[model samples]
Target chain A: MKSRKTTAWIALCASTLLAGPALAESHGMALSGDLRIISDMSNPAPRAVMEGMVADFGEMHPDLNIELTIVDREAWKTQIRNALGANPPDVVNWYAANRMLPYVNAGLFADVSDLWEEPAFEALASTKGAMTINDAQWGVPYTYYQWGIYYRKDIFDELGLSEPTTWEEEKANCQAILDSGRKCYTIGTKFLWTAGGWFDYINSRTNGYDFHMQLARGEIPWTDDRVRQTFANWRELIDMGAFIDDHQTYSWQEALPFMVNGEAASYLMGNFAVAAMRDGGLTDDQLDFYQFPKIAEVDYAEDAPTDTFHIASGAQNMDAAKEFLRFVVSTENQTKINAGDALGQLPVNANAEIGDDKFLQQGFDMLSNNASGGIMQFFDRDFPAEMASFGMEGLQEFMVFPDNLDDILARLEDARQRIYK
Target chain B: MFPTPIEKRSRAAQLSYQSLLPLALILWLLPLLAVANFSIKPESDFVNGNYWGLPSSFDLFANYGRVFFESNMPRYLLNSLLITIPTVIGAVALSAMAGFALGVYRFKGNLLIFFMFIAGNFVPFQILMVPVRDLTIDMNLYDTKTGLILFHIAFQTGFCTLFMRNFIRALPFPLIEAARVEGVAEWKIFWYVVLPLMKPALAALAVLIFTFIWNDYFWAVVLTQGPDAQPVTAGITEFNSQFRAAYHLMSAGSIVAALPPVAMFFLMQKHFIAGLTLGAVK
Candidate 1:
């Protein structure tokens, strides 16, 4: 009996050892050392999902060790800078384009051009032009979400209203919502820059695409008449009692309650807000999406920019990291990411199928139809970090004290000059 | 033959004063109450604009469990304790020794060094960010708990020394002189005589350092990146990004993160107040 037990134990140990490396090979390429992926997803939904993904990744690569640290967005940025300054992680999730430009210029991210040639990435590369920079691909595109107005469909139905197709129609709808004793819009500017999303979309719709890009690039002054006109339109809406009171004191999350309670008719937000809307007890039947409405008579193109992930140039496991990138952008994973309600992001791989999510399908269909002529990077991601900070602060000032547009624009222009110089 | 009896106040005045106490206490505790209320509220309560009102449902246990089980909060709390405890001990011990030297002995550069500590403690953290990070890296201490604790001890020593020095300066010199006259060894004098009298100061310094280090967000971010070293404050912030609009959960997490120091303060209130008021008397 003792001899039989010893033989069984030995066989068990041998089996375990044999299974480990096979598991490691399944999750793309295995790394000899530990891997760390840092993100800013500390909330329950995304955190739970990410933890599962990390576990799955670990199971598939038994030889590789994985560590995930979610820091606050602000602290994450600061920590990433400090970490890159010291020793870069094996793989990191960071922004692409100008946001990635500084880190790329600093030689902090691995150049994943070879992975871009792989069939999985090739499909994504053809679909997402923004992820490619200067003929070199930097990162994998895992999630792409559209930003627009999320309105209460139930309230619109109750009030006999329809989605507006024009700027004038949107204003009239907002006015009617207000006339019915409800706030037409709910927004918060507590961190200051959140208001910039509204400003960006509105300005893009009003002044057309190229002008907005020019403003972001500093080729056009912030104090230009076109810029002032955007604020003017916003002020007109504010004067009609269209926005929530004390908005300057509230954050985006804080203002969400108003929309969910039917106290406010609409929220201008990203696809991320879908989870919040659900958490707020607003059913699928209660929510709907609409474009920001055409502010210009000219048929200008619409552009929607998205957040992308890249490996740091100083990555210790460049080859392994690229393999991981290829795995993430693969049609299989992108479909999984899109099908999940928590993520609900549009897959950048054109050939990848998105599951039956109504809102996601709407965003995908809109993009496919080329309803938006051109895509522009989100204001914060498009401009240099410092300039973006200044612009956000300016947006807060404009919202809180609309009469200070001249001073706000002047301050923004000064900030632009300093950063550009 | 004696003192006149004191007159009683009117019933209305007494009622007003009695009413004012709870009212004032409530006013003073409004912000904390708000956080506490928000912590137990269902996400729908906030979404339905029920903020500043009674919660529709209590979810304290659920939220609290989620904070620990769903995130790295327990790990963060453990990291915080590891970083904070050693820092408190090191800073207090080092400053106590240095404070004794400066306070008991009239040495050259004593005031200069004291003033330097005072000034260094006041400089903004941003100015020190680049150089300090580089120094941490070069020391091969980057991303370690020890690296963060070491820097925090070194940085906090400035303030701790100031506090300890002044505290020791106010101690009567006759005892030290008597010990010296009796030929008590210098080390013995410091250990047996001086340390015994430093209980209040030590208690004060310990609580203060505990709070400071526990609440530290900037250094936690700068010195660490992963759960292996990051603390609760940074952890909560990271949690915020994932939940986005889940304020109830965020508030619950914030309260959980904030409770330790708050409980510490309450338990050590006397020592903390005594330490804070050390220089205020003279």
Candidate 2:
């Protein structure tokens, strides 16, 4: 009876050990507990690409599970702020520079410099400048997309219009298009950020690259004459009826069909819009690209600004996140992503090959030729997000009520002071 | 006879008002009608600017299928159900008990506690963000549906209690007195006598809670993360990002996400209004 009782106890102990591991497995791989990623990219193609990438990552690292949640741009900012104040995601998609600075200062992101030095990241070192703060690398660089004008080739040909090489010629071409009874520019400012593309290019053109940077850094006053000139040029375009009417009510996506259907001449957009334009049914033969017209200046460089990705400082699996970042910037993955519907994006790595898409290849050639004089980050990314918010609102007010430029400039100056302080 | 009887004119006016009712309803539902139309349209239709016109092709099923199959929409729906149903039941139950205590029993601080609940319901969620999240994290409930449900129940209990107490206070006190005189125990009086009479309140609160919780986006994002716990509203956002320019899919997804609450409202319109307007008349 003693032996039987002992045997029964031994069996119970063995079963309990077996059951614990089973329960863990049933709940699935949850290395570092639970992991989540949030981003503002909600379109299907990018989502499918990300989902596929995550699935592949899951297979390779069975002990780690990734959850991806997406929110609209407005909701994304609000949710991220709330989540950070509450329970932050393990990994998140956010902008680099001043955007990450506040979060890093708050001890929200993990430092991953050790992973940055790994062999897989050697090619990304060139782009890591944007992601680093106080000499510490905070996030991984996933995708770097370029910005340019995507024009309707068919409409340009029909109107006998060639890509303008200078700002004056670009305006003249727009005037001609308007003279011919076609909408000179098909743009939307419902979200207001769409108008910033115009401001970034014009400021980059008029003040040159370095001044644009200084402007973003708040070293220059908003009421400075050079700054006023940028708005003056924008006002000129508006007075010329270069922009579509009811722009305040239309989102970029909503205004896309007009460009696709040949009702409008051009869309000032980023490389990401290539996918959107194609999805709107424009074929390769029907699309063409050009740099935003350069203001005639001795100091200006030709390169447009860039968008970058960074690792969160608070990421639990910093090593894994770095590995993923390396994979993204690798020539193999960059080529694959560029070859897909998205175009005009240049891989940050010098050695990475351009994809088969002609527009993307041209973009690569432009990058290689150092045709880009100097890179300025996009306006929204370059400025403090809160200041950018007010700036965009100011742009809307300026657009809707053009007579209030002085008021707009004063309000912007006030916002800039508040943010910089 | 020459002046026309008052009853005859009243009858004509009533007939005219009834005839105009369907027309008014149609006018009110025009926006919804447009959305429903857009929900069924093929991608090509939207691209071709056929927004206000009849759909060139019907791809409703295809769009909805993509939303479910391509995204983790099934998981999202289940998560929403898990969070919302439990929140409704939990909030209603707790509020009912507290409301009874406050409404029937004349005790010190009764009005004070009641007013506190009323004022607390109006406080901005930002004030509660840090503490509530820290509490949930310490409880080891972060990122779980239970975490979301718990916060929702606690937060909603304020509004629900106020609603319930006011509702119960308006009830006849003679019913409770008669039950007590019949030698019924307090617990039994609540269970057998009062609860049955609270059916309308129960139904009304259930529908209101269902809609509120289902439509909640801010808390869904803050309290939950993975597909395992995120609700449909948050899921719709993820879906929107994934399919950036795919408006057809987005429209269909919106309709799918909105259906449950819409259906609940339609089925229980009378009870919903009765519950909402309970004290308004008084």
Candidate 3:
């Protein structure tokens, strides 16, 4: 009888728990984010930085209650679109530039242009181009990192080679590395975006920055003469066998072993690859950085991906959400988040000090260099999702069969017409 | 016994069968063993590319401790328990009644109702995501453990009813007839007579539901968000940070997540085996 009564009570309690309101009953402003700025789950530094910023924002508006939800990063990439639908959160963490353009067209994000009118907005002055779409500013960028050619420093020293500044000089360096019995570039194109990095460089260099950005924004056709020239430059590298053999079999991470094993001399990738290389036991002295070699008579334009946060179109607490955005882009908060477990990204705020860390310093010199035609937020972030997917698939196919360039370009043009509409 | 119990075979045949048993078990368990090995080794071993070698240092404590203490795993585990136990009880309760009604009643459309439940089990789950999500939102249950649990119970009833209806049909009919001659009411006949005989099936189905709901990752992510509603399987993904995936911690998380189902299996091993083989022999 006692056991039966216990079972009955347990069932009742279970039912009540399932039907009860969620942990916090008080309704508040909701801000959803992609979690984990670092690989370690035990690392509290990243959360401390974000929460510290949030607490300060809370203090300024005591009447408003705010709740933040940070989901896993990959899941967030898929679910952020859902956040824009019915039952929308007050604000969402997102990316800047052409990535935000389509959703802007859909009217999913609120117009924060008035936020730009506020004084002391000089912090993210350089990222203004990326943050703006259709002549109106959309979101505020908090953190972003640089992408460039991370090469074998020891090999360069041994062969007496310097950083390649032009296309011709880059070819000569590739030739030199080849003659020494090592390949120059090793990439994994199974997921396809890896090859898009090389395409971003070749296109930006061959046709200059304006045309390249226009191409990503779908203002130029895929089969345009400038696009053809970009492919021609990429084919030149492929014909010379500058990249590793059968790269389609490896992931971006898997290709790093070749660089570590000394079989490949360089990798065109993001700054995140540095920590992984260090994990593989490659010393700082062994690995070094340089911009992608210039291909045409164009100013250097680099791929520096930036992450941003925006107010949802149908948000309930608009004023509180705007206040949260204001705090996130502040020079102090940006500096704190960057200095915390988010160890890699350069703060969007110009005043945020680039610590004496050798990487941030080298990256700062390359990016802030006057020769830079300013930042392109990488291929995936700079193109609409549909067009980016089709382009990445085409890029992977081209990597495997460089001879099928015309067919690939024609197919991409067909997709572009349909997707842009 | 079926297949003449191998013991009646020649000595050589018996010896070969005994030898092959361990070999096949090892083949089946190899990947699981590798995951187990990974759960114990430090991240340095993987960094050094010592995948197949002995660990330089055992991190059995540190890895699991971090997964529990330093991560949102404890809360996630609690969320899973709250979501699953109720779902198992609710699904089994509903399915048992529906199965009994379909098996014993002479009602019209009985076959159609049973077929409808059976047909639902065959439809792909991915197709239900969008409409179901919208419905949950409309009901104000989206992003809650209650939403996930309720949806799990609804969908899982399809398979559970199929299992139960077939199991109920396989039982002897004269037992119910005997009880009816004694003027027992229909509901009493069900509660007293049929239910007492359903012990093996109930035990098997409860264990099966426990395993299914506990290991679920997709619906946990789809209908729920954050530590307040997500289960351990979804919580395991928190280790995959921005650029790099932490395989060592992920492996540790996976092992911890896999334990409840393994324990449930071992605890119900007898009833589970008996239920599976009941129809097979007859």
| Per-model TM-score versus the true fold | 0.80, 0.79, 0.87
Model 3 misplaced regions, further than 4 Å: A1-49, A69-90, A107-111, A117-119, A312-321, B1-23, B44-57, B276-282
Poorly placed runs, candidate 1 (over 4 Å): A1-92, A101-127, A133-138, A192-194, A206-208, A221-241, A295-305, A311-321, A338-344, A353-356, A393-421, B1-19, B106-127, B163-183, B242-246, B257-282
TM-score of 2: 0.79
Reference-based lDDT, residue A225, model 1:
94
On residues B161-188, what C-alpha lDDT tens digit does candidate 2 reach at each position? 9988988888888999999999999988
Q: Every model's DockQ, to 2 decimals?
A: 0.38, 0.19, 0.16
**CA-based DockQ, model 2:** 0.19
lDDT of each: 0.76, 0.73, 0.80
Q: List the residue pairs that clash in candidate 3.
A: none
Candidate 3 is graded, for docking, as incorrect
What DockQ results for candidate 1? 0.38
lDDT of 1 by residue, B1-282 (tens): 244322366777778878898999999999888988988988778767788999888888888888888777899899999999999999999999989998898879978988998998899877888798789888988778999999999999999999889888888889999999999999899999999888889998898899999999888878776677888877676555543655677788789888898898899998777766755785
Give interface RMSD for all predictions.
3.3, 4.0, 3.4
Tens-digit lDDT string for candidate 1 (A78-122): 567777776677677666556676777677777777666544454
lDDT of 3 by residue, A80-109 (tens): 777687678877877888888767889988
Q: Provide candidate 3's TM-score on chain A.
A: 0.85
Q: Give model 1's docking category.
A: acceptable
For residues A186-281, what per-residue lDDT tens digits would candidate 2 score against the true structure? 887998988887888788788876777678878899999999998898888889988888889988878887787777889888666777777667
